[model samples]
Target: MNYTPWDLVLDAGFLSALLIVGILLRARFKMVQAMMLPASIIAGGLGLALGPHALNVIPFSDQFGSYAGIINGVVFASLPFAGSFSFRGKLHGARKMWAYSVSTYVLQWGLGLLFAIIILGQFFDLPDGFGLLLAAGFVGGFGTAAAVGSSMEAAGWADASTLGFTSATIGVLVGVVGGLALARWGVKKGHAKLATSLAEIPQDMRTGLVPVVSKREPIGHGTTSEGTVDPLTLHIGIVAVVTAAGYGVGLGIEALWGVKVPLFATAFLTGMAMRLLLDLTPARKYVDGTTVKSISGTATDLLVAVGIASIVPSIVMSYALPLALLLAFGVVYCVLIFRFLTPRIFKDGWLERGLFTWGWATGAVATGLALLKVVDPKSKSGTIEEFGIAYVGFSPVEILMAIVAPFAIIAGLSGQFIVATIVLGIGLIFVALMGGGRADAGNRANSFSNVAP
Candidate 1:
């Protein structure tokens, strides 16, 4: 195909049209909706149709090669600005917060890895070193998958990169699936359950957690009107700082530890670290609601759009059945497991946290956000705060996982990948143990209060 700059421009237009079609279908068609159709998977399918791996309609060229990259940078760069969603005072509930974070992180990551090993590993012909990279990509999302994938390629394990990319591509699919399913769950069960507890929330807690919807507009009124200091500006600026700072910090950590990590992970960690510092100081005000919502929402939309457009269809087709099965089973298993075990093993906020973590582990920050929105639109404070912190924390984990995956493969530990998964599970359980007491206390208090009496 003879191509020119105009062709590249056309590609973008094609993708945009496809996205609109996809979104519309999501809105109108139940079978193709976000939860049922699997947004990423559908997007990916469209990409396959448009991308060179299939019809070659969106063939890669110098002009379009970096198109996806530009979109990614735009999406990611907006993160820090969105960092302000979570409420400040909520973190003060020290023991409970700690318990929730530790337990959720452990279980989410652990279960993800275990599932990868037991299910995905059995079907996909993953090379040894790349197994972890593949796992991280599918389990940890794109940043981790790419970070480790690139490392594998650099270390002369190019085959691992192939697997990693393939896995990451599928992981995004899983993310959409998991996120949408969770949203359905939240709307059906989680929402009502949470609302009951929220109705009786302490006045003080409600004060901290209630979304201070601008009184300037009536309920359901869209976007704050013009001339009001655009909260998006603050969020965009903060996100820039967070991304740069994160890269810098991750570089420093790599230099000190003599280990490479995922830049996204580093950026995420850096943002979280700054969040902690700001929370400690009087600077918490720097992160406000508008900034958080704008940054997070915009970045997520961009990421999802770019991600769907970028997955070369040929790659997806190469591993079609396995990837399909991985997503289908993973989504089914995760929802069921969390549904049953969450109530039994953990209580209240921990269940929500676990659900959110699972979404992040399977997908990315956007998935988490969508799920949280369904879980508690009113308590923007708790949901946003948790998301902001989790987004940052997830960064380093991705980088480290990505870079180390290839080595694991070369060492022939592919068969024993379950060991690493087991360790992750144990860690989650350990955190749950620490937080279980506080969660029980909170649950009791919530239950006895009859929801706001």
Candidate 2:
């Protein structure tokens, strides 16, 4: 069906209603509050149940599956504008973070491919690309999965989108529930310094309602010299402009080279360039970081709901066995990473860092922050600060892994596996070098601060 502007409005309205319902459910239910599940995930589940594939209560458009990728482009394009990046005095932390993150990516990809080649492909009638759904879902979350799946679909991978969405949905559920379990375990083991009961958590957090004090705090301000357009309007206007430019850039590359590329990569690069330009000029004063984050957050919530709602039940059922196995393996791998790998990488605050990494690896960064709050409510571990520094280097690796890795698999699955295995080997070496001797060191003196890159 040809979607008109009104169709877009209807789709937005339906999604908004589901989100509200999800917030209400989460606020009213103690179990959901304990899980710390995002309102978006809950909303997505409701949408899936009531959507065309299920009860058919909502009149969703036939082209609904495509919305995830399109909205993902918007989210990515707005990211670089939402935060500032600097390398001054953070080079060491950035390198360590990049190594750790890239290693995880390589490990996840290698495991997925090995399993696919050895078992799934051998036993089932699934294609080689089936292996990639694991990392695409678990590491990259819904946005990366949708973007990569759409690209793969253009390259003749049937049902890739459905598989990707299904993987993402499962990853998110596991991330929330499993991460909570891990945090609780850490508290019991004396790894978490500050463990509080559910009653200790702020009422606003337990329920999705903002406290009066939080509402009163000012997040952003108007520019000193306002032009014809409003300051907030200008910020959003810049995001729209860059988003379109990024899409155009992706199209230009495809038209010129005839290669299918993920639009989010170019969008990200575009946003970075725009950020750099704004920083270099006086225009940076008018652009508020908080407003940019709000825009990105809004796009992400809608994308998650639409992505989950678009899952094809028949496709999920057909691959049920493989899906279950993949998810199970993912849980084990994450646990091992938290239990074994985390202590080795960071000298101090290993539990806090591990919990946060597990949360992000499985779901998204916000999930990691939520897990971190559970362990160290006061942020005494400095996990958040160090992670922010490390992300400057880590984000690019994420984009490359998400955008290029799948295409590499498509080009030559064997070649991709070989390269991934080699990368994984190198990553393991780094992990061993970073974690081995420090395992016995109980003092923070032997931490990453003392280690050389």
Candidate 3:
């Protein structure tokens, strides 16, 4: 059957209806608010339960899953222009933050592989590249899950996306819920600073509306007059061009070398080149990084809903036990990084910083931001500021990990790749320790309860 634009429009209509309902539920239900669930997840869950998989009521097409791959290409490719993701924030705790952030990223890649090799593969029949799913899904969230899952599928793993999305779904839930638990624990232990109680988090965080003028933030600056070209359209056009060009490059590689390259990597590389070229020209003035990032976020919200709704129930069921074990191990590993690792890595604001990293290290950057907002609503903890500066070092290594791991596993270099992650993780830990943070920072803060908020 031909996929008409009308089909897309219809599917979008269904998802949009679900999104509206989800937003209403979030706004009206205190339980949903207490859980801090994103509207997209709620929308996706409704889509999943009501669509083809369960009740077959909504009539979403078979084309649902592919949207995640296509849209995530935009999400990741837009990173090069993420002005707010920042390479210019204050450098107060930048070194220590970089070490912890980079290490968490690298080590998750390694640990996921180690899980496959040491335990999961020995007992069950799985794809050789199967281990990458844990790290891909849990560490980087849905966008990276889509990228890595798509890459692994291209490498001959058939059930990759289903498993990867499953990991991501669980990751976000645990990262948020467990993160809040950790925050409370931190407060009881006298480690928390400003976030004394989760109940005290602003009501507006639960409802996505800006109730007053003072609470509103600009979406982005208009660089072009609407009479000529809308700024939003212009930004989307730029992202589309970059993503399409990257897709073309990927096709070119496959035609020449008989190899399938992941579109996300190619897209990021293309975005980087385009950003550089624009930087050298006067055209840079017309491009707004924040606006481009907004486009990415828009794509992400849709992709999350679509991705969850498209999960192959049988595939997930078949791999259920292995999924459970892998996720359990991954969750424990990430929690330890938050509990034992990052606290020692951050000299000050360990409670807040560690909690944020726990969210990011397991989920996505947004998860970190969500958790951070609850704790440091005014953004006083300096976590994101440090992250902005540290992101300069973080981006390349992250892209490299996404590029290398699947191919390495396919080539049977899993052992060597695992070793490399260990070495990198150890090196990053040493860097964090040497970067001016006290090794005992986690245990030193016992009087935080006495401090005034």
Candidate 4:
């Protein structure tokens, strides 16, 4: 049967519909537990059952092929750039904070590496050894794992893609669950008391809806009663300009450094830098606060919904087990680090809770807002400040992590698990040294002592 282009589009539509159904089921029926599997995955599972693997309604390859590019684009689009913004005091403390933050990051990375090596050797029945499979685990999570596995499958490796996807999925799951569990635990244990404390702040004092605050009067071309430019126009202009500039810069950087940083990343950084630059300028005063909030929310929501929907169902099924496991592991890890590590490392404040919240919930400043909302949904000041600082501060950290992650993949691919462990160990040491003076940094590092029961 000839798979027409229309057929491809139709398949994408079907997958999208499935995702929507899953979301509705979760909301309407409270289907599966939260901090468990994502709604998207559950939907994918349903699709798989109905597809050729079980019933042959939807062929996996055709569905996947139709939306690969779009799904990949969505992934990069959702990544946070310049997420680490802080007030002057936070910046001063950052030198100390780095110790814990870096350690936490490395701990996660190290666990992922070790998990891959152990699983590949002991479990998967591979023919060309387990180097690449391990690499897949370290680099991009389950999706990347699956991608690598698929490549290997073409080259005569059995279940390579499946194993890779499994590992990556495990990582994502662990990250989410671990992160949220920590959030809940922190509140239960007073680590999240900052949330309660933030309630004291009045609503008007919070971060206003404006994207930037400028000192200049509304003497420019367009002005509003809210004391700034038209919110809609400004937002559209910002998104358009930032997106274009980012792509341009990403291409330039790729050419100069011989490293392939995606355009979306470039755009994200560019957008962040632009934001900071605008904020620091005297012109910031003329921008309406409301516009900023609306723009940011729209961008994020669009990216999340469309991106998740476009990732054709076939890929999900092909790498189901590995992806599922990776996600599970990620959830577990997020909980562990936050509950056991964050409080010990950071002094109690909005900053502390904010860090824990953001680390797991998309690793972005949006998490700051969410944490703030949990504390006082109506207030914006403290939340905005936290979000701003986080957005700026996180950029460098993310870049650094992204750069280091590839190396971890390389080590995994080479089958030098010991070397991988050593490299990760050294990285953590640096983080500890940087954040070591802080009284809260956890000295009781995670031992392979217990796996999630």
Q: Which ten residues in a row have the lowest lDDT in candidate 3?
A: 444-453
TM-score of 4: 0.53
Candidate achieving higher lDDT, 3 or 4: 3
The full ranking of all candidates by lDDT, starting with the best, is 3, 2, 1, 4
- 1-453, model 4: which lDDT tens digit per residue? 666787767665776677677655544442243433444555556665666555777554444532432333333332332123444545433433443444444455555545545664366533442443433443344333433444454345545544554444434444444444545654566755345543343322232122345732342333344356565665456566676776678678778986555444555567667767867887666554444444544343333333233343455566556545544554465555545554454444434544434433323333333344444444422334333333345445544444344443543443453456447546754554445432221221121111000
CA shift at 156, candidate 3, in angstroms?
A: 1.4
Better of 2 and 4 by TM-score: 2
Give me the candidate number with maximum TM-score.
3
Misplaced by over 4 Å in model 1 are 1-8, 28-31, 34-44, 57-125, 133-138, 156-300, 317-341, 348-358, 368-421, 434-453
lDDT of each: 0.51, 0.77, 0.81, 0.45
| TM-score, cand. 3 vs. native | 0.93
What TM-score does each of the candidates earn?
A: 0.60, 0.89, 0.93, 0.53
Of the two candidates 1 and 3, the one with more favorable TM-score, higher being better, is 3
Candidate 1 deviation (Cα RMSD): 8.3
- Tens digits of lDDT, candidate 2, 142-206: 88887778778878986888888889888888888898888878877777655554234556666
Query: Residue 96 error for model 2, in Å?
Result: 4.3
Best by lDDT: 3
Q: By TM-score, rank the candidates, best first.
A: 3, 2, 1, 4
- Whose TM-score is higher: candidate 1's or candidate 2's? 2
